[model samples]
Target: MKISEIVTILDGVLVAGKDQMDREISFGFASDLMSDVLTLETNDLVLLTGLCNIQSIRTAEMSDIPCIIFVRRKKVTPEMIELAEESEITLIECNYSMFKTVVTLAEHGIRPLF
Candidate 1:
């Protein structure tokens, strides 16, 4: 699904990379553990996590995740947003909890099984 469709589905806030809104995302990975992210392998992964920090951005960069969803009303800092921007990663924030975020994406046909 396109990132724009995701934003519309989740009503997520686009904190950065507005241009990426139209980019196509093939799948998603919901994880808060960086180690878990390091182990998983996928292209165009849209990561969902409540850990809103620079580490999350770094993890996403290393894992090549195309976009990130800050779950459960977690707020992403300006520095993290800048880091994502530098890496050309799309950052999205939403009030939905982690479970809701994953379910919503799955319902929208953005499952991780790709």
Candidate 2:
């Protein structure tokens, strides 16, 4: 699915990387742990996380995650957005809990990493 469609489905707001809204994402990896996020080796994956911080952005950069959906209504700070922008990672903010976000995306044909 496209990032734009995911934003609509999750009732999320695009906080950054508006140009990437058309990016295609096929896998959903939900995690609040940056360490766990670093273990992924896949393409076209979106990181669903509630840990809204610079670490999250750094981890995504290292893991090559193109998009990040902040769950549980967590807010992304300006610093986080700056780093995400530097890494060219799309940032999305949503109110859904992690589980609900995962279920919703899965229903929309986003495959799980496992």
Candidate 3:
């Protein structure tokens, strides 16, 4: 699915990387644990998490994740956004909980990373 479609599905706000809206995302990984995120081999994946820290952005950077969706209306810091921008990662904010976000993505044919 495209990042634009995911944003529409989740009623998300694109906080950064507007140019990457057309990027393809094949899998979704929902987690708050940076350790778990670091364990994955992510490519063309969108990370769905409530964690709004810079660490989350770093994890996405290390994992090569192209996009991240912050769930439950979590607030991302300016520093986090700056880091994500530097890494070329798209950041989105959604009002849904992590569970709802995952379900919505699945219904849209976006599979789990596992």
Candidate 4:
């Protein structure tokens, strides 16, 4: 699914990488643990998490995750946004909890990493 579709589905705000909104994403993984995110091996992955920190952006960069959705209305810092922009990662913010974010994505045809 396209990032635009995901934004619509999750009612998210595109906080960075607006140009990447048309990018296609095939799989999604939800986790707050950076260790778990580091173990993921997939292409075109969208990471859904509540960890709104520079570390999250770094983990996504290291894992080659193209997009990240910050759930539960987490505050994404300017440092995080700057890092994401530099890393070419798309950042989105949503009011839904992580569970709801995952469920909404699944219901909209976004598959899990497994």
Candidate 5:
């Protein structure tokens, strides 16, 4: 699915990288642990987490993740947004819990990065 579609589905706010809305996402991985995030070796995946911080952006950069969804209504700070923008990673903030976010994405055909 496209990042644009994900945003619409989650009723999320685009925190940064609005230009990347057309990017395709085929999988998703949800975690608050940056260490776990670093273990991913997949592409076309979106990171879903409630850990709203600069480290999330850094982890996404290291893992080559193109998009991040901040769950549980967590907000991304200006610093996090700047870092994400620098990495050209799209950041989304949504009110859904991590579980709901993952389920919704899955129901919409986004496979899990298991």
Candidate 6:
């Protein structure tokens, strides 16, 4: 499914890259560790992190993650939103816990190993 489709599946808010919503997302990596992300296989990356801070967004950018989904209803700052906008990364906010979010996506055909 595409990022746009996932947004609908999860009832998430698109905070950035509205135009890129149609971009297909084959897989996602759910984590809060930036270093691990940097070292992992993350080409077609959709980041799911509970760290509701600018660093999360920055880490996504550094790892070339096309999407960032903030789990656990954590709200990101306006600055992070703007950064995501500038980076052209799709950002979504959802109230689901990280485990629930990951499981839900996996059950819906989005696997981390893709």
Q: In order, how many clashes per candidate?
A: 0, 0, 0, 0, 0, 0
C-alpha RMSD (angstroms) for model 5:
0.6
In candidate 3, the residue pairs with backbone N, CA or C atoms under 3 Å apart (3 or more residues apart, or in different chains) clash, namely none
lDDT string for model 2 (66-90, tens) is 9999999999999999888888899
Residue 11 miss distance in model 5 (angstroms): 0.7
- Kindly provide the TM-score of model 4 when superposed on the true structure, using C-alpha atoms: 0.97
lDDT, candidate 5, residue 21?
Answer: 95
Q: Model 4, which residues run further than 4 Å from truth?
A: none
The Cα local distance difference test for each model comes to: 0.88, 0.92, 0.91, 0.91, 0.93, 0.85
Indicate the residue-level lDDT of 61 in model 3. Answer: 89
lDDT of 1: 0.88
Q: What are the models' TM-scores?
A: 0.95, 0.97, 0.96, 0.97, 0.98, 0.94
Using alpha carbons, what is the TM-score of model 5?
0.98
Candidate 1: tens digits of C-alpha lDDT, residues 1-114: 999888889999999888778899978898889898888778677989998889999998898888999999999899998999999899999999899999999988887843
Q: Which candidate is the best by lDDT?
A: 5
Q: Where in model 3 is the C-alpha error above 4 Å?
A: none
After TM-score superposition, what is the CA distance of residue 45 in candidate 3 from its true location, in Å?
0.7
CA displacement after TM-score superposition, residue 50 of candidate 2 (Å) = 1.0
Please give the lDDT score at residue 64 for candidate 2: 89
List RMSD in Å for every model shown: 1.2, 0.7, 0.8, 0.7, 0.6, 1.3
What overall lDDT, based on C-alpha atoms, would model 5 receive against the true structure?
A: 0.93
Worst 10 residues of 2 by lDDT: 35-44
